[model samples]
Target: MSFGFFNIPAPVNEPVKEYRPGSPEREAVKQAIATFRSQEADIPMYIGNEEIRTNQKVRLAPPHDHQHTLGYFHEGTAEHVNKAINAALSAKDAWAALPWEHRANIFLKAADLLAGPYRARINAATMLGQSKNAYQAEIDSACELIDFLRFNAKYMAEIYAQQPNSASGVWNRLEYRPLEGFVFALTPFNFTAIAGNLPAAPAMLGNTIVWKPAYTQVLSANVFMEVLKEAGLPDGVINLIYVDGPVAGDIIFNHADFAGIHFTGSTKVFQTIWGEIGANIHKYKSYPRIVGETGGKDFVLVHETADADEVAVGLVRGAFEYQGQKCSAASRAYIPSNLWSAVESKVKQFLSEVKMGGVEDFTNFVNAVIDERAFKKISAYIDEAKKSDQVEIVAGGNYDGSKGYFIEPTVIKVQDPAYRTMCEEIFGPVLSVYVYEPSYFDSIIKTVDQTSEYALTGSIFAKDRYIIERVSKALENAAGNFYINDKPTGAVVGQQPFGGARASGTNDKAGSALNLYRWLSARTIKETYVPPRHFGYPFLEAE
Candidate 1:
């Protein structure tokens, strides 16, 4: 059916729009936000070509302004999950049989749509729904998502171009086939880019998907589905549903057609899903591929030679941005005693200047966390630290949830290196600092490595080249995405290729060709131009 090789457009990162004062983008986004706030959206689950609405409507609201209603989404039951699975299965064969270039083009068009017409709307939704500031929403929903779509299309082409070598009179070829059954994409609430990528990545590779997004992220997720539909994505390719996790998992994992799952969430939930899959392994046609990026106790290690100003900036930006909800956020720091005084001073000053409020207020650097649950979990850590004699709350331990789930960007100085806050993943704007003696640098590196079970990301600040090399080698296994002088968060698509190993994730490197490989099952074909007349080999007879 195809004549010649097709090349996709060269992939490039989308330019992030800075919503500076007096800019058109700022006004556009502000207007978009106001427009969204004006309407009461009645969202429904998208299954196949139908928008299914049920009696159980869950109310949605912004985290900062909980009393104000945004809209409501129709929640689904186990039967709806079954319907989604059936829809995905029904469309799987046709979707996979479609030419690779067509599939690539669909996603490419979606990327352009997001980058141009739909940018402001999607960013505004993420800001209101996920409690992110304007800049954070732009980088996540607009720029990073565009990068994923564009780069993933290029990666798909590269994957298909790989061929096998032949010897003598034999010709060999390799065909990359989609997984036999449908893929389940369980997306997170933190980043809109991730929510889009989890399902789009596999679907781009010609696999139909059953996408279940976090309830908090449905507003932006719905906008993404609209983009895909407008880009000519066929019905039933990616069925979006809002269902309870356990109920959906119970039916999906036990099904014979369940092929794989791409997940981004907590460690406990991932483990539980893995156990359920293992328990139901015999029911499936083939072993399901499980890929996930779970929790992170990410860290920052500052050397004595590191500049105090640079260290302070890294701490403030890395720890507090997006309310420290990023898996790669710097939750813990190991600062040398010599630089502690200066770093602490700068950190305190920065926190004092920071303002917390709603996303509509562009002057505010910090906004509310995702929900009340996260607020309670993070504030509990701060409360325990305040009560402990071994820990001193250097700056910001105040919190108020009456108007909104607001927690001040708090920093705790712990006497013990293995304090609860340092080891545990408190996914909020809380940073725990441990001042170590300069002589114990080697031991501190080991402590940092051994402190947390997660290996998602980390950064070390040092001016000395020798120390950098030594520390790099010594803590090689500590983090998958390690930085020298920069912060651990904000991994660019083509540049960084983010993911981690150990408890963090499969480390398949989502932004590169590596992640696309996971969705394909390769088949090798070998053909001989000339066949032997006899069954027996001449070499065997001669020997």
Candidate 2:
């Protein structure tokens, strides 16, 4: 095939299916879930073209119904991580040397595969394996994942289109090079889209990858891998392994070929990974590029002039969707005292109407937390609130973990805004509301800006244009994906380039051109058409 300038299909956000009654998507997903529940899958670690199954295994169950066995996955050791690392390195040269178009084609094809034939199965796996309801799974596993793949391809083309301007008698060209060594993509359990993007983003830029998905997310991750494999992704270009974080870290961190890591998880884990890389800096062939997006104590600040209904709906949806597993989920809110009453009443009313259960039941608005650890951690906070006079559990403080890790949509009204629940990243469906005097809006903005180390996502609601402008400017650095009047959650790909700074992460702005830049290094080439025969003649004559 003759090489020529290639243009990727213009990227657009994948339309999220409503999965409403009698909808094709609804019935298809229901059938997919039913098909999945009838069997157990034994997933293995992928290295090159091989699937390696270890003696030890990790049993998998849905967070919404822990009693039901969905499947189990092979658990690998440090040796396996080493093998995956070796596999990535073995294919790095040929893979990176392949034309950029070919590389992008694989991901584009994979996106189409997911958007079409593989959509139902992927969504079903996410629902059964991760406890996400139909809508959440549709947005994450189906829509957002497709968006990442499609947009990343377009962004890759955009990056390659950038070139240096040339002067007379000189021609200048720039080339984007894949990282010299392998990239390790450490993905989280919250979003399967992120689980796919973290690795695929790096791989799309022609870097080979060793991906270690969160154990709780392996089922969906495996399906994602299958999609890529079927899309004609070359063998050994991207290896998948299921192993302990430390086991993988010990081997990967110290390896001489360790190039970089693409991470999305908790702040503590990202910190540990960063520290290990720093500790092993001397052992690596080059400085490893560390790109990560971590935890957030995200907030929503409502003004006196804000729409009461919108504020209420925003709080309920932002703080409780997917059981608030989103890193960008709103955990803290500052509502004007005048609006608090209406917002609280509406929020309570919404919660009263919300049904919590397995995702198989389409009527359920909220599902289970990822596991018991999350349930206990969140419930402990709620329990402390119940015991304290400083805060009131305004709504839904109940929890039932006998069958699954379920916590009702909880809202605690705190007198002290600095309370732990207000400042900390709960990573659950718990929102801490603090009603503030309208005159103290500016003061509270400053407080919200400085309250937590995180600045992932936050929202501002105000009908007053002055208030909107003032608050937006005041909380400028408060969030990466700042919302005008909408909820803090649901940062769409392409349109809202996601990420944040400080404790939140490196803020690489995934789903855009910026994130792709991380996996590549650039080389500038300048060719002089006319060369001076004598090196110093022009300067000497002029002088």
The global C-alpha lDDT for each of the candidates, from Candidate 1 onward, is 0.94, 0.93
- After superposition, the stretches of candidate 2 with alpha carbons farther than 4 Å from their true spots are none
What ranges in model 1 sit over 4 Å off?
Answer: none
TM-score, per-candidate, Cα-based: 0.99, 0.99
Tens digits of per-residue lDDT, candidate 1, 288-385, equal: 99989998999999999999999999999999999999999999999999999999999989888999999999999999999989999999999999
Query: What root-mean-square deviation over C-alphas does model 1 reach?
Result: 0.9
The residue-by-residue lDDT of candidate 2 on 132-187, one tens digit each, is 99999999999999999999999999999999899999999999998889999999
